[model samples]
Structures are given as C-alpha cells and as structure tokens.
Target: MRRLLLFSGLVGALASCTTASESTTSTKPDRDPVAHSTIVECILYDGMTKTSPQLVTVTAGTEVQITDTVDYYFMKARVVKDGKTYSGYLQRQCFGK
Candidate 1:
C-alpha cells in the first residue's frame, strides 16, 4: 500500500538523520602550563580582542595569575595593584615563565 511505503520511507529518512546524542568532539593539542607568571612587558586589555580598551599598563616584574588561556597570543590574567585586583587579557609574550 502507498501508506506502508510512505511509513517505511519516513522511517528510513529518520534513521539517516543524526541523533541528538551524536556530536562532534574537537580534540585540541595540549596547551603549555602557564598558571602563575610575572609580567615582563605588556598592556592588559579589558577584552580578548586587540581593539579592546587597555585596562592598565602592566609593569615589568608584576605578578599575574593566569585564569584562562584565550589563544596563542592572549591570556586572561589577574593582577593585584594597590590592594585592588584587576582582571583582563594580557599578551602571552609579555609574561615570562
């Protein structure tokens, strides 16, 4: 019957569709550890982008706690200055191991 054929086609189509549980898992290379480090030279930005406003000029020898690694060039860092804690994105190259 046409109804039976339609039902089978619908079932076939449903089977061909991806399931909700089926997801793609992207595996990224392990990032180098950079938990705590000192600022050698750089400016801390309010955001991760280059166009973001500069929060502060991190002087050399300033201590920083890396909260997150955004990418190859930037990391979210926290610095304590004058009893105030500032959080922002800093250039990775500005920090020393």
Candidate 2:
C-alpha cells in the first residue's frame, strides 16, 4: 500500500509539472516595436491591400496599435472592441499623429 501511494504521488507531481510547462509555452508573445495610435475614422481590412475583405468599420477616437507600415496610404493595425482584439490594415490618413 505504501508503494502504491508513493507511485500515485509521483505521477501527480509529474502531471503538475507538465501542466505548468505547457501553460508557459502556450502564451503568445506581443509584437515588437509597435506604436499605439487612435483611429481617426477607418476600416480595418483583412489584408494589407484595400481590396481585401473589410473586417470592421472603426469609428473615430477608437484606439489602435500600429504594427507595420505597408505604405504611405495603408498600415497594419490592431484594434480592440468589446474586449476582443482585431488585427488588419488601415489607411494612414485614418490615424492621428
């Protein structure tokens, strides 16, 4: 009975360690060198191009984080609405300085 208890304890410890390691590894790291800005008024496209499907129509004063600049006209941006994060392309003119 003592050996069985010891074996069960060992298995429980191993399972806890595995769960901790998996949780750490599963976390997603944030993008590097990002700039926070506000949306003046724009639509977040699914792709860098305007022809891509429109994801959402962000209103003026909405907060956004600029991840990448596609060009003078378009930029890769991330938005948060209703506690959910949204990523897509936005026009440069729609961002405030």
Candidate 3:
C-alpha cells in the first residue's frame, strides 16, 4: 500500500508539471493588419481659414501592403517621398490609404 501511494504521488507531480509547461508555452495574438488600397497624395486642410488652401506636399502615395497581419496597439503607415521613406502613425479619421 505504501509503494502504491508513492507511485500515485509521483504521477500527480509529473502531470502538474506538464500542465504548467504547456500553459507557459502558449502565445496570444494581438497585432492586426492595416487595410490600404491605392496610393495618393494627401493634403492637410486648415480648419480656421476658409478662403486660401494650405497644401502639404506629400510626394509618395499612401497605399502600402502589410507584410504581416497582427493586432498592433498602434497603426503605422509608411510614406515614401523624395526618394526617402517616412513612417508615422495614421490619424484617427484617415482611411483607405
């Protein structure tokens, strides 16, 4: 009876260890993909002035393909202009590249 109890205890310990290891190895997906279509030049419009238009020259189009799809806490867009690439977070209202 003592030997049987010892064997049962050992088996329980091994099962608990296996369960802990499996839980630790699990990973959660958080990053999400940004949807972008055609690239186009976007100008920032001034809200105060109604007559004259203030145009910010964006050399590169906005459309960019997402290399990976994951839920990123922040949405980032890469803009290429004047042979240089610039990366920045997308404004809340901006969409469709």
Q: Identify the leading candidate in terms of lDDT.
A: 2
Q: After superposing candidate 2 on the true structure, give the runs of residues whose Cα lies further than 4 Å from its correct spot.
A: 1-35
Better of 1 and 3 by TM-score: 1
lDDT of each: 0.79, 0.82, 0.48
TM-score per candidate, chains pooled: 0.58, 0.58, 0.34
lDDT of 1 by residue, 7-54 (tens): 999988787675533656646665543456555767889988879998
How much is the lDDT of residue 12 in candidate 2? 100
Name the TM-score of candidate 1: 0.58
Off by over 4 Å in 3: 1-20, 23-27, 30-35, 38-61, 65-74
Over 1-97, each residue of candidate 2 has an lDDT whose tens digit, in order, gives 9999999999999999998987845567766647555546789899877799999988888778888777888888888887888888888888666
The predicted structure with the larger lDDT, 1 or 2, is 2
| Candidate 2, residue 41: how far the Cα is off, in Å | 1.9
